[model samples]
Target: MAPEPEEKDGEFVSTGSVLRQVLFGLVVAFSTLMTGFTSAWPVVLPKLQENPRSFNVTDQDVAWLVSVQGIVGMCTSLLSGHMVEYFGPRKLLLINLFPTFGLWLLMAFTSFLSVLYLCRIGLCISTYIIKSFFQAYIAELCQAKIRGAIAALPELIISVGVLVIYILANFFSYEVVTALCAVPFLPLFFLAIFLPESPYWLMRRNRTDDVKASLQRLRGQRENVNNEVKVLTRTSKVQVSAWSQIHELRKRENILPILLVLSILSLREISGQTALFSYSVYMFRQAGVEMDAFLCTVLLGCVRVVTTIIAVPALDRAGRRPFLIGSSVICGTSQLVIGFTLLMEIPGASWVPLAGLLIYVAAFGLGQAGIPWILMGELLPTPVRSIGSSIITFTYCLLMFIVNYIFFWLLANIRLGGTLCLFAFANVILVIIAYFWLPETKGRSLENLEVAFVKRKRLDQNDHDSNHEVTIELPLS
Candidate 1:
């Protein structure tokens, strides 16, 4: 690795460290590309439903196939969160590759509906574990100054994966696509082996030398990482039982961050991105778009990738709060345009939904799709990071399953226009909450954030003591 980049006036002045971090992030983020493949695989399900190539399947079966990952994900997320805390991310990630490869192999060859359901469950385990841990891993790896940009890489790569799978599906059989998904794992395994473990995790286990060595590798061999090691020593000193960590959540300092992250993630689900991407083709057809729905879905993927590429780099510069608020506004407006255009039955407006979808995907890709996950790492304190993240991940998957399971019903009961308008209204709520309450995490170290909360708790206690003293001093009231 190159030497650590220089810091000038508190900003990174060279690309060497940032480049190294991004490279590591991208390699680890390849796991998330599998998430994209699984998410977009539903686009091909309708075609399979038309033919039932080798297995007998129904619309209900297809819905189960599409939504079952979320159920399995909820369970695995809790396990993986604990696993990440115990074994650390690097080992857990390497162990994850075995199941991921095996599941893809099964997917490539399976003909039975039961076996395919089993494969989806395995896929969810591999990918969602990565989803649950990688953000925490990357946040530990990179500095706060450039953390937002580096953390956002996974979202960008996921979009690219979606676009790639869409293009491949146009010309290849589902089996071929399934087989090809396994190929990336070979490189991922080799690349992941060389990446350093999280120094914070190392510190928690009393591996002081290993923590320094890991910090050296992450910061570059030429750099002196002693200061960083000292910070890790201070911040990661708490070693407690998992139940004790869970009890920590009852405190104001810990629970407030959990609430912040949970609210953000809940709002992310309510924004309908998961349901939108999962059912993009069906949604396009329902909107009466004259363009080919598959083609429009592919375009949506392309636009998502391009916009995320452009927008992610600006995240650290513009800060998370503004990016999220701006992205929410555009998303709401685009949904409204689509809803109005469809509901009014405007003549020659068959093209409107496609146009609106492109705009929505672009805006959603800009920040909404990525930032909440990034916050999962930034906001959660070390003492409760694992449990807090697990709880949030469980809720996220549950909401995802609910939204996906009920999406068609929502469209049937209220029409596409009304369903989209409901999603738009969600954005409105997100914007209001975010503007007033979301703290600016840009350029703030994770250690500093933890200390800030501790200080706030102290101040609150001091105020309470002062009030008690005043009550004692009063004669009669």
Candidate 2:
């Protein structure tokens, strides 16, 4: 086997090359446009409430509109990695975008709950494709050191898109909102028309010249393209099937990382993140904040956008494990305090919960919100990355559904504080697990991670061999 490439003193690629940066920016913009619907949903809640009778939709029915999106999103997420691997990111992304854009346009005309649900499912599938492909695409493009930073651009743009939609929806009609959603696809359609396929994808296919040309165009370094292509080609092995790749992972020490990714994602969902967003108005109303609940939710969206902006530069600098551990601590504490405030029936307790909730959002934005997706893409080897990422996404979506379902049920039965407390405890557990098990992947190359696992497994095998030899010698007597 060829020796693995070592990180050289100056070989650390930066996202500074103008053309590459422009491409990266375009990709991020596409992600933001794709994600605009998420924040827009909160903004449109009031509109849905205003004409609930016209649509014959109940609060529970509207919630399903959101919930069904989450359901289909999870399903697509679990499957998307394989789709990306099989079909390639460029093709899958382009194919997914048309339906996604079409769904938004269709949603503008739909008053029927069934049609709305179908549109949401289509949106979910598109979002899933976008999320998986975008992450994998960035991962394949950037070097290890700046992977977190590059990966973070999508999340940052997502925040900006949310803020923009929140502002627009505040002033615009539902039709305008639908049009704004469609507008993102127009630019993305043009960009996809010219965008090169991922070099790593080409490498996987053994098209070395195509990989080299792609890297040359994407990185703006014609000479270095061959070197990078050589590195990727050296390690590239074709898997016959997605299931076969997943089975290979099962035979490796991939369990801990998989568990950690799932736990991080589960904690993110179950911690009432979406519940707070979905029911922000109701929570504030109960607290007697006396503000327009829709406005409050929009304000909340603004806060999230601002905090995520702050997180962008800090994420790569602070390292992953610290952010994960620290955020969990903050999230847990905030949830507990908010729960207690609600439970105590303190005067102006609504402010307390609101403040805690904002802090929780900030903490999440700083850490789990963006980090899990980055880590999910980074932790696995190239061969199984698509399958592994999909699995993680699948688990995340399933947990999200369970959490949202339980949250709604609990909100009615136990009230707000009790519901939040459940998430608080879950966050506490996540903190402990993350502290103990999650290794810092900051600045570590993907190849190094693979070697580390391989070496560890070899050491374990040697230990087992020694033990067996000792047992045999003693038994001979």
Candidate 3:
């Protein structure tokens, strides 16, 4: 077994080891940034509609454009787990970039509405796969202490991409903006060539030498990673058939984490994240803000990026549970405020909705935006991690599809305030569930987390036995 690394702030604190992790995290984050670009591409919806050369596009068309990605993502997300297992995240991510790059170009040159929708469909598939791959990739690559922050990098980069597009949409032609969106993939393809394969994945393939080599690169040469290698090697030995894997998922350990993760993701989308991301410009416009909607949307993106940046370090220090609970509280409150402000149409208070939205974005980026993805990587056991993520991502996309598809209908029928009130109510529920149910995964290794989940299930089942004791320890040398 390798000697234990020094501990600081609950993470194994080695500056050299941490620096390597951060560099790899940044390269992977570029792919995530492209997803962000695709998500916020609709910021150009108004421009596309107004351009004489572009196809005639209606509000209905915009809704379809926004919501279609979710449906497309649902189809592709199921394949992500299997694909990651087969091709490995590094190779799959590189392959995904090709379709993504070409699709961006297709959107850049084509003004036809049908072609644009097809391009969006293609991009959605690529991005969903990218999202799933990176979550699994980072989970396997980084140590437990900094895992949350590294996993959250995608969400932060996504926000940066969103902000970049919002600013660029104001200045660039739609063609130029779409063309520029392809830029990330170019560098990411080259940089990702240097990204180390997951030590865990290598272990599962019976490549102990490769696993050790991968771990050394990820952990830095001075660090001993033998103990980590042994742990993964042991995990890899427990291979199972597809039916056995399905049966394994029914166990309390697996079921509990799945339910908890799905709850977080479902609440996230139900609280209107998809609607906000896809239609912020339109949402602000419909809210009747006296301020420029595009500018307001850019400001909202800035808040998202800044708050997520602040949360990155804090994620390791303060822990996941508190951030989630706090975020839900703030998000619910902000939405409630926005709903009432719009409901009353309070004379001389046109800024309230926009202000509330900025508050919402800040709170969301601070916790909700990144935590679920972090938790997804942390909670599931390695044997079940791939398939579990696929199921979770599939459901997430399904919910996103439903939310964006009906957003305008809700706005029209319930009014914007009523619709927002519904989202606020959903957040209030999330606060309660997170407060009581979610586990604290700070500074714990992935292997330790697996044991914790199983013991947690045993404790739940044997509640009457007060004599029973369970202690989950962090990994030692």
Ranking the candidates on lDDT from highest down gives 3, 1, 2
TM-score of each: 0.90, 0.86, 0.89
Q: State which candidate, 1 or 2, has the greater lDDT.
A: 1
TM-score, candidate 2, is 0.86
Summarize candidate 2's per-residue lDDT along 221-334 as a digit string, tens digits.
633555556557655566537777877776444554566676787777777776777668777776566667767777777777787788777877777778878988998899
Model 2, C-alpha of 11: deviation from truth (Å): 1.1
Give the clashing residue pairs of candidate 1, or none: none
Worst 10 residues of 3 by lDDT: 1-10
lDDT of 1 at 46: 59
**Global lDDT scores for all candidate models:** 0.79, 0.68, 0.79
The deviation in Å at residue 289 for candidate 3 is: 2.5
What's the lDDT for candidate 3?
Answer: 0.79
Off by over 4 Å in 3: 1-13, 52-61, 111-115, 236-242, 344-346, 456-477
lDDT of 1 by residue, 1-477 (tens): 111112212534246766777777777777788788787776566556666767877988887887888998899877776788778889998888766777878877888888888888787788888888888888888888778888888899888888888888777877787778777876778778988998888888888999988877776777777767776776775654577787787776677777777888898798798999888878999988888887887788889999999877898888787888899999999999999888888999998899898999999888898999888888888888888888999999999988888898999998999999999998998887777656667777776566434422233333321121111010111
Candidate 2: where are CA atoms >4 Å away?
A: 1-22, 45-60, 110-115, 288-292, 347-350, 455-477
Q: Model 2 — which ten-residue stretch has the worst lDDT?
A: 468-477
lDDT of 2 at 173: 74
